[model samples]
Target: MNPNPLKILVLFYSQHGSTLNLARQIARGIESVPGCEAVLRTVPKVSAVCEAVESSVPEQGAPYAEADDLKHCAALALGSPTRFGNMAAAMKYFIDGTIPQWLGAELSGKPATVFTSSSSLHGGQESTLLSMMLPLLHHGMIISGIPFSESALGHTQSGGTPYGASHVAGHEGRAALTDEENELAFAQGKRLAELAVKLAA
Candidate 1:
């Protein structure tokens, strides 16, 4: 184990609890690594109409992620709910605020992974995941993805992809994460933490 626990910031936006559940599973997987710790954070919602004021801290669940979280993290795992084949606006807004970190190269050379949940199987899980990766790539972080050999990818009738971990919450947007989806999410997190350790060395 490393002397300092590898901290992987699990930042995500969950509107219907599906993405939030996935984030918890991923955090569990990260902490499973011998020298890794999971820092769970969530972003506040934004209004589409005009200025939507959110408290500095959220009313419930993890506080709004801070720019400093990116600075100190050994790795990152980002998650978001689907929004018309893309990540939600709130998550995008949060990422957009990381310009300072990007300019300072604070996240450069870090390992990162993305996860998403959709209302339907074809609701653009892959697209949402790719969209989330773009900002991390601009920050110069290496993108990590789940391998097909995970078996869950091959067996998941609900949601699993080689691109990254995902869940099909169905049109009803349920809370239950299928067994295969949960396994894949955990696997992805574990892989990210392991890579962070190796990179830190």
Candidate 2:
């Protein structure tokens, strides 16, 4: 691998914190791998009002992600709450601004993964994960997903997918992640980090 520790960016957009929880679990998995460091970052919400602007730094939780984070990350784990079978507007808006990186192939050949949260079991978690992958694919990222070998993937009643890690946040979007969801999220993170190390080497 590179002499320095690998920086794995854990980037997400959460409206009610379920997605953030998944991001944290994924980060834990990333850090479990020696020489891999999890760098947590978030994107600001987009406003319908033309003049509304978010502060540079988030009020709490992870700081806002910058283009440089994408440029420098050895790998990425992207998460967002499901928005009508797709990624949230905030995440999409942030990704829409990554044209410069796409042009330069800044994230090309890097390993990446996706995660998401939804309010119900059938709330399109897999589709949300797939939606997030499109932009990363355009950037030439190597997408990674949880495998069926992860036992939780077969048994998770609420949320777990081969596409990636996911959580069923339940009604009101306040449900804590189930044990299976947590395990799968961590596995995805660890798996992504491992791939990053090998690819970088």
Instruction: Give each model's whole-structure lDDT.
Output: 0.90, 0.92
RMSD of candidate 1 to true structure, Å:
1.6
Mind sharing the TM-score for model 1?
0.95
Considering every candidate listed, which one attains the maximal lDDT?
2
Residue-level lDDT tens digits of model 2 in 75-113: 999999998999998889999999999999999999999
lDDT for model 1: 0.90
**What is the TM-score of each predicted model, taking all chains together?**
0.95, 0.96
Give me candidate 2's TM-score against the actual structure: 0.96
Q: How many backbone clashes does candidate 1 have?
A: 0
Runs of candidate 1 with Cα error greater than 4 angstroms are 1-3, 48-52
Query: Where is model 2 poorest over a 10-residue stretch in terms of lDDT?
Result: 47-56
